[model samples]
Target chain A: MIHIRRDVCGYCGACVSVCPRGALELIDAYLTVDETLCKSKCKICSTVCPLGAIELEEQ
Target chain B: MKEAYDVLVVGGGPGGALAAKAAAEQGLSVLLVEKRPAIGAPVRCAEGIGKEALAEFIEPDPKWIAADLDKAVLIGPDGTKFTIGNNHSGGKVGYVLDRKVFDRELVWQAAEAGAEIQVHARASAPIMIDGKVSGAVIHQHGKTYEVRAKVVIAADGVESKFAKWAGINTTVPLTELETCAQYIVNDIDIDERANLFYISYTDAPWGYIWVFPKGHRCANVGIGIAGTKSGEGHRAKDYLDRFVAREFPNGKITELIVGGVSVCKPLECTVADNLIIVGDAARLSDPITGGGIYNAMYTGKLAGEVAAAALKKGDTSKMALMVYDTTWREGPLGHALARNYAVKESFIKMDDAKFNSIIHSMSDLSLDEITVKSLVIAIFKANPWLALELPRLLMTL
Candidate 1:
């Protein structure tokens, strides 16, 4: 699973752009993750987040 | 809102606003939707744009002009400084903008041109009919509307969900994506007439730090790094914090903004059946500078013109829309993108020593015209070793 620290997130949508699965979306200023589509192994979003808001957690 | 329209534009940034305005002016019923509560708030841009490029779209307004820069200063990794006057650079480096007000002015113009505008409207999914984007499912104010349209312009920006939903591969590779963080800092002494850019491989790998003046004693201080270089303690914000602590210790942070820029090439094709993608959604930002304002507005206006013409001809297919892609690619904007991408690739691979050498070499040059080609030529004359190191960059020029 991907853990999003909303408090730290700037809602810049950098993670959403690099998500190959198209699993991340920035609705206004809130970031949402589609669990079913999100692949934990692909940590592209985690790496690209300028604020380090998204993290991959062990299921 | 009507159940159908001639054109539907997603997003409310400069791109979507211009698209709506252009299409609506052509007598097309256009609907422009923004997910945000207002047109432009919580701004995400560095807000610097060239004076002439901007004049092509709208006249200059004092309300939105933060500062009229007369020169640009480049600081190398080893602190070698090189200054380029605005006239020497062909007046390319110009105003720093107040995007919050600038974007609203654009949206206002669109509305005045008869484009129906709606805020708090989010497009959750593309209404695909047999794989063709007919419209979108817009969620607004706790309700969803299945809006239909003859043409859909996806100006949804770097997040760009609409294009991906409509089946365009809009993913920016980690190495190619520039992660940026910025702060609106006040009470700092600065040369307001000059935009300062600091290039340091150790500090901001594959990107640069900038201080664009907003007004006296205030500026947009920011840094960007390649997405692949960002991590837990080495994120764009981390580097930015370090720079701010050193440069502007007494500066007050009034606002903080972070975002991603696709420094890769534009989309392979910007159109599909009944669809057109413009602006950051199409990844048209400058590869070297990470600037997208002019590119977004340029493509937005072009897309609107193309969409309107196609609708009048009663053909909204991909074949008809390819003109939008072809026209931009063949024009000056496209040529600059290609050349700059090559320059960016070469520059990012260079070490601190190479950067210092290049800046040192150019510090004494007095070129009347300061284009990229002239700069490269000057560097070759001063440091012939660089040609051997980056022959590919020279080949592109």
Candidate 2:
């Protein structure tokens, strides 16, 4: 699963653009991840976050 | 909102604003929607642009100008400083913009030209008909509207979803992406008229820190690292905080902005059936400087002009809108982007020693403006041996 630290997320939508599965969405300043579509091992979003807001949690 | 319009523009950044302005000036019914409640609040940019490039779009205004820069200072990884002043940089350098006010000014101009403007309006999905984008479903202040248009322009900045929703692949490669963090720091002692850039692999790997004066005792202190180098402990903010602590310990941070910049090539094709993509959405940001304000405005104007022409002819197909794609690719903007991307590719691979040597060699040399040709010539002059290894890169430019 993907864990997003709301406090750290800048809501810049960097993660949404790089998500291969289109699992992330940035509605205004709020960023939401559809976990059903998120792949925990991918970690692509976590890697691209400027603030290190997104993290991968082992299921 | 009207059920239909001659043009629909999504994301009210410079690109969308310019597009809306151009199309509406042509007597087309234009509608521009911005997702944010305000036009340019929470600016996600370093707000620096070449003066000449900006003049091509709008006249220089003191209302939005933060600082008029006549010089640029570059610090090597070893802290050796190289200055490029008016003599080396050409008399007109650039300006550090107050993007918050600047963006609103642009949108206001679009409104003046008869483009219907809507803020706090989000386009949730592309209204597709037979795989062709006709318009979008917009949610504005708790109300939804299925707006249709003869042509749709996607000007959504980075984190572009409009084009992706329309079946265009707009994903930026992780390696080519730049994760960035910035703070508007006040009460810092700074050279108010010069833009300073700090390059350090130890501090910011494959990226650099910038101090662009926002006038007086304030500046936008920022850092960007290659996305591949970003992680838990070494995030862009981590490097920026470290730099700020050492350089401006007493500086007060007033605002923090974090975003991603795509330092990759422009999208494969910036147009599809009934749709056109512009600005950061088209990946037109410079690969070397990571600057996009000029590129966005330039391409946005072109998108609007092309869309207006296509709409007049009653052919808004992929073929008709292809002119927008071709015109930009064949222009000076295209040439600059190509050359800069090549330089970025070469520079990203260099070690700190190479950077130190290059800066050391050019510390006293008088160069003719900042361009790929001039930079390559400088490198050749400093190290004749490097010429043998640069031919392949030169060929691309």
Candidate 3:
């Protein structure tokens, strides 16, 4: 259940820095979910995005 | 080591060094500490000081000044602009300094007045005895030692955490914060006579972009955006990077610095038993402009004197330290800061069109005539809609 939209986002990469699951990387200044390292164990990454730009993997 | 002193100043930056200088000048025993191995290594500031601030606090030494400026250019959100000159003093409309040498000059003044200083001595926690500040626990060369003192003045900069240990509320709300990222670049074209303040409502939000020229050749180009508007840490920096790429497609990126600015009111209380807070620690930073080097030095001097007086009376109570607050509020630095907060809150509401109109109205003013408030007034005059929005803006700030 990821929930990020690229158009309105500022590309600050706060999610990339705070991601515990190593699920994100900066792509053109916005976050790009790296499926290889992502674990849906917790949704902390989605919750901390200030712009509400984070998307989650489905449960 | 149970070494005792009359006053202990922490952090070797501008405020700390000046506080130590002021205390030493007043004939007090003082010990100043810097965590770094050298006095002014790893520079972090844009190095712009107004003339009004410098003259009132410390005299300029030729050894540290890089250039003397007499003009400023305020570029509005929509690219409309104006310049001002000959209207301020102390780090005023002039002087891009060599901050490393400048910082050393201040500390040197304290040493000239006989204050003991220790470099490479990193102060950790404040030493409290029965609710009284005794001194501090310091770390250096991989070992911890204790130094006891009658009073301590906290002149640590914006990212300070020392006040929390002493029980002072030092948190600054995000809306009043500015996230800045700057690159000191060479081969950039600029007026040697004018300091640039570039702004935009959508881009910087509550803050503005600054391109301060170091000389005729290089400049410190940076952007400051309201931290809360991004609603996320680091977004402001990313915006700065984008802004840079879009504007200076060919300029080489040299040095980069990322930091935050506090444009909020100073804390209600900056003093505690045997403890006095000065400069960035107390949020004396101008809410609108995000400048605090002057306030830091001014408060540093006062804190030094107040600490000495408190010890003279054998009373190290927080009440004695309150004198510093009273001293500052009655003076130019505090009064100017108070007036600035009101003006800063108003400008934060302006959009790009509003900004352009304001700048368009004042395209002919000299450096002496340009001011943050005057520009807001122009915006209100051109668009009565802006005039009606003042009340809401006041409340938000």
Candidate 4:
């Protein structure tokens, strides 16, 4: 699962654009991730996030 | 509900605001919509604008100015630095604006000109009528409304899909796009002036890094990299983080901005029947510097004027709106953008060694002789081997 540090997120949507699974959406300036659709092992969004807001947790 | 307007503008950035203002000033009922709750939150720019260019639009309001910069320092890959004082005529002098205030002011100006302003309103797609843009379907406050207009102005920024929705090809090649990441850092030691650091293909890839000082102990530190070089394992934020660590170790980041800049030439066609695209949607930003405020205002004003005239003339066809394209491309702003794009293409191909040599050669010339032609001449004089490439580069200019 991915953890989003809401305090650090700038809500710029850079992560949302790079998400391969379309699991991220920015609604009303808040970034929401759909865990159901998000690829568990993939860390593309976490890597591309400028502020290091998105983190992947160990299973 | 107000379901109709003379000109419907999508996006509330400077471009859209100015377009709405201009159209409204001509007695056209205009409505400008912005997706954000506020006009300029989450600023995605480095906030630098050329002094002379900005002067043409409005006087510098202290309310929106972070710093009045009069010099630019260029640092080469080898730590060689050349400083250019903005006191010289024709040199670049500019200001780092408080974009939050600046953008809102423009929107306020639009409202003052009689244009209705709507925040939190996102345009989903163009309202098409027989293959022509009639207006747009907007989603705002959990409800959708079909708004009709005589003309539509798409001033939406880099991620604009309105142009595509209207059947214009706004696709930018990856090589021509620059992915950017910026941080507004506080508690950093910086000169009152700004610095542009060029590091060949290592630190920033094709694009460069900018440290624009805003005020005391605060600045905008950012990096832009060619999109083609920024996928897979590498990203612009990675480069930016490394640069920030190396330069401002104690700096605390107050804001983070990530966005894409289209560094290609302006679209050959910026108009369709009942539709005109301006700003980033039209790719009117400078290809070399990634600065779009002035260009956006210029094109937006022109689009507004042309749209108003077309409405008055009772013809909103593609042929009628083409006057906007012709006038923009033929003006000084268009010519400068085109020239800058050519210079950028030639500059990107030069390696670090070539860039160092060019900077060394440029140091010998006076500020007056630092024109585009002189720079090319200096390059040729330093490396006579590049004579073959010089012609091709010059042809682009």
Candidate 5:
């Protein structure tokens, strides 16, 4: 449902740290997601994101 | 004859209520006007607040609270990380308040102190005499009337147009204003004890994203950007969306509020003759956090006290009204506000790598140093750019 660009992510890790679903992580200097772990319960990280790099698709 | 009030507070927000409370307790007659039909309806905040700053004015009540928070996230422009750790600036540690109830409680408290309140009344301008501020003009239900008072307190909020009428300069430079927007969402699972602030350099450049959880299932998610940083093209809503689409592809925006936060220094003077400005009207908001509830109440209390004193002395002039502005700036909130503005400036300049390093690193530091300055300093240690920005902020602090 959510997409993060590895190239432009800049690896700030803010999204990784703040995700309530425990969905995001930092791997190789970019943001990664634990797709299996995410409940799609809520996505607070994308809303409060700083760089505007996030994109979402409907389930 | 119904006599004029001793203290007339324009606005029934936290500032107005507190102003009325402080004045009435001091034995001054007070009147509070609210433009809305209700005291605390249509809540607009992410609903988060530090607890200690709140104690400066009133005691904590669970009747107005939803949750406690103990963490912050600092992301960079490009998704880099910075972690500020956990800190308590306001008392009792944290909260995600039920603002509608919370605000009404404040008004009730003021009323208990003998302050009168009127809803749906919009204050227009100050009632002046011989070049000195006295009271204000109000319009309600298609009827206009002039209310006279010894002291008038303007708690009209940020972007308020009252100061011009009172003959005071209240312009907030574009650079000093932060355009903010938010969404209340359902089904967000978060630690009830920890709140989240997500920052990224390329993500928000001048603003950060916030997800203040109401409980294990609900959250108020939002982002805010410094005005003039990205120019007309920069929109808080757009940033919020882009971030959400990436992080919360499934979450939908349930409620939205577009507003602004001011990071500029407090107005040079908040008092003009018999008139005193509190809250956003006087720019008492937190620059780094963009939080104003606690600070607004703090300033409102001070404003009310000063208004009461002026009435008692029959000297509602500039000399008698200086009390409100001087007191708060010297208190704990004011001390933090100054440090926060400096942090706000440094924060806007960071990129993702620095933010990432700092935020990820925060997981290792003690949660106590999460003050705005401490977080910036930690990130500065990791990034030379931040280190370079520190000097200017440090000098000001």
Candidate 6:
């Protein structure tokens, strides 16, 4: 699962744009990730987040 | 129960607020809606604006200003620094704004002028009747409501969909869109003034790195790259991260802002029967600087005034609203944006050596002699080969 730190996310929607799978959406000024659509082993969101808000968990 | 408004302004940024204020001041019932929980939260801008441009809207209040900039330093690709004093009238002098305070204040001003404001209201789509926009469907707190208005001012930002829903073409080519990433960093060593560093075709291809100072040793450091150069292996964040690590190694980033800016010419049509688009949705941002705050508010005021006039005449037809487009394009703002777009196109094609030479030539000229005409002359004088493209460039202005 990918973890999103709501406390730090600025909700600028950068991750949503860069997500190749269209798995992220900004809902009510918060970044909401759709796990089913998120590509496994994809680090693009975590890498591109300016606040480092998105983190990947170890299986 | 639902009520109809004279004008419904969407997206409560500077443009939306100003439009609402202008309409309400004319005694027209106006409503301004913002999707955010609070206005100006989750800032997506570099927050810099020219003093003169801002003066045309409202007097500067200390409550919204972060730093008053007196100079702008430009760094060439070869690491040569050229400093320009902000002494020129109607240009150069600027301020880094606290957008949270600034945006909220604009909305407050609109409310004070008698415009109703609603936060957490998201405009889902336009309500069209017989191919004409009559109002919009808004979603708030998991409930949907249809709001009717005689005129709808689309002040939505870059990712705007209202214009498209209204049957207006708002497609932007990838080449004209800028992918941007920024960080609000603290404990950084920077001059009190702002600086724009350009390293053409490298590090930030077709874009530049900006460091806008905020007081208390804090600054907004950011990078923007041409959209065409940003995918498949190149990322704007990678470039921004590298620059931040090298320049502000000891700095702590407090916030991250990511967004896109359209740097194309204004859309062919910004108005269509009872609907007008202002601000970024209208693609009013400067092509070279990616600055839209000043233009957004300027055009927003015009749209509001025009919409009011159309209402007074009891005509909200597309023909009546065409005046807004004409006034904006023929005004100083339009001329400036068009000219800057030309400069941006030409500047993006130059190699590092060409950029260095141009900067070298500019370094010798006094700021007073650095007008657009003179700058063109300087470029031609530095590298005569560019003279062939002068006519095409001049025509854009």
Chain A accuracy as TM-score for every candidate? 0.95, 0.92, 0.72, 0.92, 0.76, 0.91
lDDT of 2 by residue, B1-397 (tens): 8999999999899999999999999999999999989999778999999888999999999999999888888899999987776554544888999999999999999999999999999999999999999999999989999999989999999989899989889988888888999999999999998899997788889888999999999999999899889888888998999999999999999999988889999999999999999999999999989999999999998989999999889899999999999889988988888888988887787788988988888887865465546666676788765667777675764
Candidate closest to the true structure, highest lDDT: 1
lDDT of 3 by residue, B1-397 (tens): 3388888998788889888988888888899987767787556567788765687867777777767777777887666777666545333466777788988888888889889988888677889899777899987777898999888998766655566667776756656666566788777667765788887876677778887877766777787766556645445556677777776666777776655567888878888998888997788988767877888888998899888888888998888788898888777767667767877767677678877876777675443534555555555555566556676543322
Worst 10 residues of 2 chain B by lDDT: B366-375
RMSD per prediction, one decimal?
A: 1.6, 1.4, 7.5, 4.0, 12.9, 4.4
The segments of candidate 5 whose C-alpha lies over 4 angstroms from its true place after superposition are: A1-59, B1-3, B75-92, B229-234, B360-363, B377-389, B395-397
For all candidates in order, state the fraction of native interface contacts they contain. 0.88, 0.75, 0.02, 0.12, 0.00, 0.18
lDDT of 5 by residue, B65-145 (tens): 777666655444445444343455332457788888889999999999998888887776677799877677877788788
lDDT of each residue in B55-110, candidate 4, tens digit only: 87778899999987766766777767765555554335678999999999999999
DockQ for all models? 0.91, 0.81, 0.06, 0.19, 0.02, 0.18
lDDT of 2 at B177: 88
Alpha-carbon lDDT of model 1: 0.91
Query: Candidate 6 on B239-343: residue-level lDDT in tens?
Result: 889888988999999987887787889999899999999998898999888999998999899999999999999999999999999999988888888788888
Candidate 2's C-alpha runs over 4 A off are B87-91
What local distance difference test score does each model get?
A: 0.91, 0.89, 0.72, 0.81, 0.70, 0.81
For candidate 6, give the lDDT of residue B117.
Answer: 95
Candidate 6: clashing pairs of residues: none
Which pairs of residues collide in model 1? none
> What is the docking quality class of candidate 1?
high
TM-score of each: 0.97, 0.97, 0.82, 0.87, 0.80, 0.87
Docking class of 3: incorrect
